[model samples]
Target chain A: MNKPGNLIGWLRKKLNGISRLWIVECLLLLAFGAVGARLVYLHAGPNEVRIQKAQDASEFTKSLVPFRGRILDGSRNPNILAISLGVHDICANPQMLTAATNTELAVSILSAYLKMSKEDVRYKLRFSDKKFAYVKRFVTRDISERLWTQITNNHIKGIYLEEATLRSYPQNNQACHVVGFVNNAGVGSLGVEMTLNSSLTGTAGVVKGMRDGKKHEIYTRRTEEIQPIQGDDVILTLDQQIQYFTEKALDDAMAQHSARAAWAVVQRCRTGEILAMASRPAFNLNEYGAETDMSRMTNRVLSVVYEPGSTLKPVTLALAFTEGLVTPETMFDCENGSWFYMGRILRDYHPYSRLSVADIIKKSSNIGTAKIALMMGDEKLHKGLRAFGFGRKQGVELPYEEYGILPRLEKWSGLSCSRIAIGQGIAVTALQMAGMMSAIANDGFLLKPYVVKSIASSDGKPRFTAEPVVLGRPIDSKVAALMRYLLARVTEEGGTGTRARVEGFKVAGKTGTAQKPVPGGYSETAYMASFAGFLPADKPEITIVVVVEEPQPYHTGGVVAAPVFAQIAEQTVRYLNLEPTEPVEGAPGAAAPAP
Target chain B: MARVNRKKNTADQQIIPPRLILTVLTVIGVGMGYLGIRSRCEQLGSEIKKLESSCEINQRRLENEESKWAGLMTPRSIEEALTRHGLNLTWPRRGQVVRIYDSRANDLALVDMKDAVRFAELERVALNE
Candidate 1:
């Protein structure tokens, strides 16, 4: 053995290397345990929360648009006036679309699909720095499907589709004013579209889903999605057949007379339903934006107001008959078609020296009507006229309907009473005139005029319906009967409205040729020729009002407007199948419902 | 040269337990189970998304067909078609129609034609007055 100190020193030297190795091995084992612990924490601990948070951060919400409603006619064979069709708006995220991809190939395919030039497509794709861009809009269903297939098959990144709707008026311009059209921004701009827009455009839907950092939808992680609710449909009380016929008649009248404008309204006599309302200078709903003349877009049935001229004679005579002021056999001296009343010369188109009350209305004599008004006085005339649905909105389902001017009794001028008696001083709308005549045909009850019949929800269940609202009875049934009989005589031989007679049917109507009022007096040339009439006079079915503004060659209501009324009436009578009745024997002076 | 030569043989003689090996296998099996569940969840999400999109597309198609049918039946289009094909149809008159009356249905009497026919043909038809 060696010394103790020497032995200890030799053993320590050998263990020194081993001690360093053991320290390194312990450190290595500790690192492995720490790494294993970290892995477990990441995979099963707060990592799940982080992953969910990541998904939430990448999520986005999208809005889905709903379909707009349709407008349908009231005919048994309903025709669509306005409808909305589904379309797609082709869009792209510029950041993901054209960068680092086959730019040429993408541009070429999109260009062909969009019918755009490849250079244009490429330029648009390259120039936009925005994340989103509209490539094309209002893409049809056929083209959209093809494009969708192309994009999906080629895995076109960033290019997307947004659901959009397109409004279509298949009638084009026929009944356009009533159906109206959607604008470039898809808002209803006129007529029924503007009137009932809330019911037409439905509520939009929302969708919540997760997207990756690349703005790609993580389809599996969708949170919430809702289908959009579609809009309610509107059914109108307009008969497309009658509307078409009325439009055709007005169009022909406008062309023939070189008139500034023309309009017509046909209403069901008993129900007060507006069968048809049409105005000329109408624009196409499809190209409504291109229509430059603002006035041409006006629906003149309730908008335009003018003096009704001789048409007021029937109203005056009805008032007299209602008040027991005159009988059909009572005579009035017409002063040979001219008479000075309240410092104004009241004249008739034809000179009549003496006319019974029935002949006075049948001949539409101004002096006779003025004399009768003089007998009744101003307050009575005003009350009678107001009761006839004048100077009030007919409550029709249309926009901007006017209550035509009817000055109060206190505001009557010196000649107001006499002049108004001849349909000159007062003004009335075409719809009002039609409604007034319909009341007479409906046996004296003034029914509120309405166009929209019902509104149905998206599921085809009716949400609201309109029933006939009777305003009031302006006359007794007996007086209305006498009035109808007197009106029938106006369409007989030697009467002014003989041109308005329909074959196989005894027609009843009055002619009004109102001279447009100038600054100081009436115009010598400008006139509104109008005829208000009903057919099968014994039992009236429909009332028609035809007005032609400023006829060129013939300016009289009898010549210009009466023939148009005849054309419309004949067709309508045939369409409605009104049977021929035996002509009542009156001998030119009898009234009182042919009793 | 080294005193550790005999210690190695003893260390090498010790063997791993079956339970420890089973534990290792169980950890691997749990990891694979998590992967399988995650993959299945992703697949189900994709299928749901596809189904939703399909439902939406079908709704769109239905709406589109309704619009098409309505547009095709517009009066102007129908009139154009009628004029284009030279149909030249007109409304039938009253005389052109023949009435096949059912004696059981008294409601079939012609409208606005009662007085003249009823009074004149009273003795002609064998019916109670």
Candidate 2:
């Protein structure tokens, strides 16, 4: 029994040792197999989404918005009319505020700095389920700084400031319509702002890199970085000094006449550069959205159209002179101020029996001017008017320019030639009238008006420059010279536009008091009083046009509009320091001031 | 016999290779230099980040100041200042204005009489009309 027991014990020990070895080997083999499988799977696996999610957790790509450009006024040392200033949007992360966080204190502090109600701040911070909420947008720098200091000192967890830009018009309503205003969506809405939006908006940049727990970029681990390109700055042809003078004059006129609206344009005759263009009832650009009436935003100088009245008379006479149909000396019978032609009565403002062509213009005789148009006929007149930039857009650097209504030849009635010659049956913009006067001023060459003078990049590199563009030569220089001489007489003692005379300059211009066209034929009470002309007629420098809409009791163009023209011309000529074409009273060898 | 003993003593001394030692020393030196440069690069990058942030803050402040200056420099503000100061100013009279032709500032009274007469032409048409 002892020998068998000993043999059994020895077998058990041997078997236990072999089985334990096998178990250890099996476990090691399994571990090795598992590791090998994982290696293969990692190299070529269907875990693309998982890998991307992991990468996204550690990597961040941020897009940076570039700076919007500025709008500058035309001066030797330019003034910033419209600018984009760096501002901050105060925001909050409600999720970051824990139970231990004193949210009430944060809200109280935010409301005080943001100038908002405590309830508004509390609602945004406590009740909002959103991770992010804007407390106030475009806060001033001082407010943002004070809030940041409070947050740091109090150890507030949720509040942050996001960088932003605010478009600021420093001139306020001075050149509001010209500089235009930006909408809530940060888009240029009108005038040159809308026209040059693309050039003003710059390209955005991108950065790709790793981020830390605090969401700050790990610069050393950055993979890609593309820098942003800033936008181009636009320099306008509008001189701020001249623009102020113009706006003041329009405001005075609006108050004096109790007119519904008024608009004016002052253009450099040689360059077609707009020195000053103003529309009445202008709203402050900084508070553009406050004015509920959007019609006040209309730039009437280029957008509004009306019957040109006697202002078109000079254009007609200039056309006639171009056609060689009549000289200044050509005589025509006025038929005692009224003439019946084609079933319509053409009448002059004052009675005249007979007058030469020059005297007809000087006296503004409607019958005599219409007789000359009758000789030209409808075809020649329409063609001639088209050549003079009528019934078309002058392509100025402004939006909503109206093509003043000149009917097609087929639309002309039998009396069209007679009536149109007297500045009826034709609609025209103030810009067109100014351009026509500019043509006469610039030797019969019609120039395209432009407001933007030049564009420069953020690096101060010139991107574009606007030069004087001659649209067409509607009349010969000889005819233009003769027309200028004829128009100059309108500001003389016996002419209709005598009020338009500048004291030290030879003022040449025409006045129009057109009755507003209503649903029937024309309004008996409402009239548009307008004057279009230039100064120093021999060497013209500037052309000015003033239009007052629906002026009370006094509605004559000569009485209402011409004085405004003279006021603008006098100041502008003095500001430009133009050579005195007139003699001084006391200077040696000089004559007295003009009558 | 003594010289042979000296030679034997010299032969018993161990020999070392200069080239092998130099190669190992160069490898260790290069490794230490690479580590130093890498550490310096990281320090510079951190400094650059700080500077960039400071620059951005300064730029924002500058823009704010410039915008405020522009607002104060507007024509309306100047006019208001004038009114506040009670400064009564007017445009110079025609006779009082004297334009400098070219670079010269000669007295108008002493200028060529013919030039002054040419200026007189402006008034002639007023009487004629």
Candidate 3:
């Protein structure tokens, strides 16, 4: 109700009483309230989002690598065939490296320690735009330590190491095909490595954590962690010494005979464990990456098949003997080493008019064997061969093993019985031949062969252990005894396998010299000479088979294969310290003692 | 109103409460203790990191030594060493071995005396051949 001028003056008077200090205080209070409200919003409402934002800024996740397993031989004190050694992959942050002071000095030091060219090191280290590059991979522990010391002492920037593993074969190419090599991607590529890859490769782990401002992991802030598991170790049944002996003998024979290729297998007769299996043209595991020839990597003993020639004679004769069709004294007219049966001509290495069953085996008379097979006919012979584990895989631990060709009974042709009986028109692997010999040595029990002895985990827990598996009993124990007796004479005086005798022990064996089949007919020049045998015929300990492919000049089994067999058997018996069962020829205890 | 004002002034003039002072002091002490524990945890974490790295280095070193040992034990290595030393060692032949029979009293008898002599002759003949 007062006048406008009076009201204005009164308002001015009230405003003038309020000081600037009061306004400043009011502004400060407003700022504090705003700050408190923001804190409440972050700490109380939707706090998880703020926490997640902070973690995203500083947290990191890393994968942990697992260690691969090892392969060892089955010696009393096992030899390591393959192993995985921890190594480092030398890496660099090239952007930081290029910006680092004294970059040339660091490059020179790295090159010297890494044993690489200076240009390579500089090229890897001088990329200013790149964040990371590999300076070197799989650097050994010794070299990595030296480089680490240099880096720390000289304050070299951006150079770091990533942990990894390198698969190594200490024995080089000695058991190359048995203990295969690992590829660059940390995977097993061949042999036992390929077959047992899963157990040999372990599981990796994960670790998530928060890193500090300098990009260093803050271990206390680790959110999650898992421990990696190591792979299992595989132990093979090979004896290193015996393997050495067999390989050495085979090498010498290959050179002596000018052979194209050679392979051999040594097995324990009682237990079907392969002691040594060697093939020529083997590739070195350490240098497998450089090898280009596929033939050299082939394990011919288990992978290749050929006509077994006369080696199958003993099997046929054993079947005849089992069916009570013939005895050691049973006589057969050998037709003077030539006979016609089912419109096929059968001939012997020697022309014998008449021979006992035992002499037929001793002299390797094909006509006598065919006549015996004619008596037994197709049904019994086919059943007997199948029972000897011919048509199927032996289920050995090796990879890519072929089941050698064994025709079925229904597939047999008119001349199948006589021809198959003489070891023609039927194919067999060297392993199959050795198994057949082992069956006889085991008293007619056909045992499955295996090379891997045991597999154990990193914690010493057994994963797999091999036990001798009896596949089948083909012949009776009595027939097996008679077969062993007749086969023993094959290595005695006037026997075809006389060269296979071990100076002081009786050897039971068969010799085979098969012509390599060509397009239209058999090759007259190329032959597979093989000898399959066991020592101390009465109580056999070891069974050995040696096959030499395409030997020149001398192609007969006794000439090319038996001597190698003799050398191996002699060395094995001496190495095993096997007590001599027979006296020396001129020893006082011998029937014909020295004067 | 004068009486009320006098009561308020009296209350304001009283000494600061000991419980309030203790509470303020305890809050500062707890903050300082939290700082101390946090710093100790960081220091221990750094030490653990260093120890873990050293452990990894030592593990690599041990693996290297083991691989070297295995390589040395291989037959090829042994044979190379023997050849380098010019040692032509060979296993004894069967003719060179002598059998000894043991009895209950631990009495050992050498068997095949005549055979041993004959073996020597045979070895001589083999050498001649």
Q: What is the lDDT of residue A113 in candidate 2?
A: 82
> Please, what are the lDDT tens digits per residue for candidate 2 over residues A470-521?
7887887788889889889999999999999887688899999999999979
Ranking by DockQ: 2, 3, 1
Q: Distance from true position, residue A308, model 3, in Å?
A: 1.3
lDDT over C-alpha atoms for residue A485 of model 1? 96
Better of 1 and 3 by lDDT: 3
Best-performing candidate as measured by TM-score: 2
Chain A (alone) TM-scores for all candidate structures? 0.85, 0.90, 0.89
Candidate 2 regions off by >4 Å? A1-46, A94-108, A117-128, A212-214, A587-595, B1-32, B102-129
DockQ of each: 0.14, 0.19, 0.16
lDDT of 3 by residue, B52-129 (tens): 889977877887888888888777788889999999888655555655433521121212122222322231111100
**How much is the lDDT of residue A392 in candidate 1?**
87
Clashing pairs in 2: none
Error of 3 at A346 (Å): 2.4
Model 1 complex DockQ against the native: 0.14
lDDT at A118 for candidate 1?
81
Query: Which residue pairs come into collision in candidate 1?
Result: none
